[model samples]
Target: MASNIPSSAGRNRLAAPATPGAATTTTPSRRALSADPTSARLSASARRPGGAATPHARAAIRAIDQRRRTLFTPGRTRRRSLRDQRETPRDILRNLSRVLAPASQPLPSSSSSSPHRDANDNTLATVPEDDDDDFLIERPRFSLPLQEDEDDSDLKVPRSSGLEDENYTAHSIELPRRAWSEGPSRLGRESMASVRFSDYAGPEIQSDDVGIDSALFPPPAIEEEDSGNVMLGVGDSPERLDVEESRRQTLGRESLFGPIEIPDMGNETTFLMAPADSPTREATVIDAAVENDEPGVFDDMDDDHVNEPMDFPESDDEDNDNMEVPNDAENGNIEEPDATTLSKPMALATNRGKRRKLGKKISKHGIEYPSLPPGVVKRLATTFAKTSGVGKTKISADTLDVIMQATDWFFEQLGDDLSAYARHAGRKTIDESDMITLMRRQRQTSASTTPFSLAQRYLPRELLQELRMPVPVPIRASKKKSRAVDAEDDVDVT
Candidate 1:
C-alpha cells in the first residue's frame, strides 16, 4: 500500500511556494486551502482536497507552455507580394515580350506625333516594369560590362562561362549582366499585318519542272506546223462569191448535162460549181473521152479540156450490188447470210450463224439441269477408280451419264438437307456448325470414318493437303512407335 503521509523533504518542497524562493514550512492541507481560500488559491485540477504543489511546478508548467506555444499554433503561409498578386497573366506576357522587343528608339521625323499606329496596335497597352528584380519571364535580358576599347568589344565573349570574374568585378554577389536593354523580337509581330490575307504563302514551291496541265498533252509548239507534219490547204469553195464577182456562181442542169461546149477564156478567172441539188443525176458522166481546146475554168482551175469520164453503169443499175434481204417469209428465196456476220439475231437463214448449244435439258419438274460432257465424266470415273486402287479405266457413255446423274442427285439432296438444318437453327444462311452436324449425321448413317469417305478419297492430293481431318476424340500416340521396325520381307528371305 502506498503511503498517504507526507515525508519531511516532500513537505518542505510542497511548502516552499508560501513565500518567494522560501523552502522552510510544510504546505497547508487542501482543507486549510479551502478554508483560507484567499490565502491559498488552487486550480480546478489540483483542488480535490490535496496538498499544495511542489515549488518547481510553476516553472515546469511555464516551460511546457512556452514549448507548446508553437506546436499547437497554426503557421503563417507565404503569401505573394501585392505586386505579383495584382499582376495578371496578360500583364506577365506583355512584360516578357519586352526581352525580345526592339530597344526603344526615338521615332523618325513623321508628320504625326506617333508612327503609323493602327487601331489594333493602339489596343495593346504597354505594361510598366515593376523593378529590376521583377519576374524572370518579365526580365529575360542581360547586358555586358562597358568596354573602353571598340576593337576588344568586337571580340565575342562566351556567356555563362567560368571567366565571369574578369567581366563582372564590381558586384561579387550580383549576377553578371549589363543594365537591361531590349533587342529585336523573335515573334515577328511586325509581319502580322501582311499575314492576315488569304494568300499568305510561305516559301515558293520549287521543282525540277513546272508540268501542271502539260505532261501527256504538252503545249503545242507556237510554230507554224502542228505535232504532225501535215499542212492544210484551202477548204470547200463557197456557193457564191462576193458582189464584185457574183457572175461565176451559175450552176444549172443545162450547163452540166449539155455537150462539151468549150467557151473562150483568157486572163479571166472562172469556176465549175455543182448545182445545190446534186443527187438527182442531173449530169451524165458515162461517156467516151472527148477533148476541147477552149475550156471554162474556175478562179483556181488549171488548163482544162473536156475531162474524160470513166464508163460506169446507170444509176438504176446499181441496185444489184446490195444483197436482197427477205423481210418476211413470203420472200424466203433471198440471198444467204454472210459467213463473216456474227450477229445471229440479224441472220436470215435458220441454220447459219446459230449459237452453239450445250448439252442442257429441262427436267419434268421444270428445273434446268446442266449435263456433264462424256469426256469430263469419263475422266472423273477414272480418277475415282485410281483412288479405289484400280487401274485407269474408260467408262461407257451411258455409265458416265448415270454417275453424273447420281452425283447431281446427291448434291441436290445435300443442299436440301443443309437448308433444312439451317432453317431448324432459325438462320437463312448456313454456317460451319450446321455443316459439322450434317457431316456427323452422314458419318453415323454410312458408318464411315469420315463424313464423306468417297469425297475425301477422290479429292486431289493438293486439296487433301489443305484439308484438316476431324476426329471425335484425340488419339495419343506412344513415344516409341516407328513403322520401320515392322518392315517385313514378304517376297523372299535371302
Candidate 2:
C-alpha cells in the first residue's frame, strides 16, 4: 500500500476540523526542549529531532524585524523640481496679453441685457460699425504740429491672436493725448539782443547811462579790408616800410632794456701772444707733460728769479709814469714791459716753490711741520697710542707733531686721489658711486689673500646692488682662531 503522508504537516493540521472542545497538552518547541533538561528528557520519548537556540539568536531576530519595518517607512517630504520654481514662455506671454488687453469693448445695446454684463466680455469682440465719436477721440494727438520718426520696433506685434489684435487696434486708434495747450514762447527779442554787440561787452559791460541807446561809447571811424588787416599810416619808402615791419615782427618789439649797449671795444688795448705761448696752448702742454710723468714740468719756470722780493712803485705818479706811452718816434717802436709779464715769475715762485717758513718752527732734527693745535693733536696722539696698545704711555711732543703731519699728508693724498678719479670720469662733482668704484677697483687690484682690504671699509647697499656685487661677507674669525692656536702652542711650549 502507498504511505499515507501529508504534503505540509502544519497547514494540514491547521485546516483539519477539531473534535468538539477537547482539553489539549501544550507542545514545547525544539529550542525549548534543548535548553531545558526536563523538556529534553520529555522530548527524547517523542519521535522528532530538534536544534538548540540561545538569547543571541532571539536578539538577531528582533533586530532584523526592526530593519524591515524601517526600510518600508515613507519619506517625510514631497519631491521638488526646477520646473515648479520657474515659469514657461507660454505662461509669460499669457500674462503679458492679459495685462495689455483693453479694459472693455463697446457692445450694442441689447434691450434685455445689462451694460455691466457686456463690460465683462472678451476683448476680441466682433468688429462693429466705425462711428465718428469713437474715431475722433484721439484726433487731437494726430492734429498736433510736432512731427517725428516712429520706430518700427514700437509698431511690432505678435500675430493677431485675439487679445493681442485688440491691444494693437486700441493702441493705434487712440494715441496718448497731451494736455499742454500753451503757445510757444516769445524768444525773438532775446535772440536779437544776443546778436547785438557794444564796445563794452565783457565784465566791463556798461550801464545804459550814455546818451546813445546802442553803445556806451561810439567807436571812432576805422576802416578795414576783407583781408582782416587794418590800414595804418603810410611809410615814406618801401625799404623804410619793410624795415619798420621787420623791426616790429622780429622780436614782437625792441629789447626791454632799450637796445643793449655794445661798448666801443674796438679801441680797447689787448695784448696778443703767439699761439705757442697762449693760455690754451700752455694748458694743453701742461696736461701732456703731466700725463707723460715729467717731474721738471712742475719746476719753477724762472729758476733764476725765484726768491726775489717783489718791488711796487712808491707813488701813484710813478705807476702813471710807467703806464704812459711816449709818442716820440724813438720810443714809439720800443714796447713797454707789461705788468702781467713782470709779475709772472713772482706768481710762479710763490705758488710752486718749496716751503719758505723753514726757519720759524724747525725742530733740531731738521723736520719742518705745519701749525696744528697742540691740545687737539695731543688728544689724538693719546687715542692713537691707546688704540695701538701703548696704554698710559706719555706721547712725546715731537712724536705727536709727527703723527699730525702724517695724518695731514694721508688726508691730502686721499683728497687728491679722489679728485683724480673724479677728473678721469669727467665730472667736477664727486658722487657716492665714484668713491665706490675707486674702492672696488682698489679691491680688485689687490691680492685675493686679503679680500676685505678695501681703501674704504664700507660701501652703500644701493651701490652694491647697482653693481650686482655681493655684500661683503664678514671674514672668518681667523684672527681670533689664529690667536687661540698661538696661545695653545705657547702653553704646550711652557
Evaluated with lDDT, which candidate comes out highest? 2
Tens-place lDDT digits, model 1, residues 1-494: 13423654464354422222221211332333335322222221122222223323333333333343323222212233333544656447657756545776434533232333332243344325432322223232243332344232233322232222232223123222221112121111111111111121222112211111111122222222111111211112233211111111111011111122222210011111111221211221111013222334221132121121211121112111111222222356433433212232233123112211222232222223444555676787787776787554667767775786676556556666787799999997986557657876876423223333334455766665444333322232111111111221211242
**TM-score of each candidate?**
0.21, 0.18
Model 2 sits at a Cα RMSD from the real structure of 49.8
Residue 356 C-alpha lDDT in model 2: 26
Question: What is the alpha-carbon lDDT of model 2 when measured against the actual structure?
Answer: 0.33
Off by over 4 Å in 1: 1-374, 386-392, 444-448, 451-457, 461-494
User: Candidate 2 regions off by >4 Å?
Assistant: 1-375, 437-494
> What's the lDDT for residue 47 in model 2?
19
Model 2, residue pairs in steric clash = none
lDDT of 2 by residue, 1-494 (tens): 12323423443354222111110111332343335422222212121111112233223333433443243222212222333444656446646756755774434444324433443352235225434223322223223221253222243222222222122333223222222122122111111111122222332123211111121123222322101111211221123211212222222211111222212211121111111122233454555555645445433232322222221121222223323423222355443434433453355344322222111131211122243555776876776677787756688868875675665555444555677789898997776546655655766522222222221223456654543343342233344334445655665699
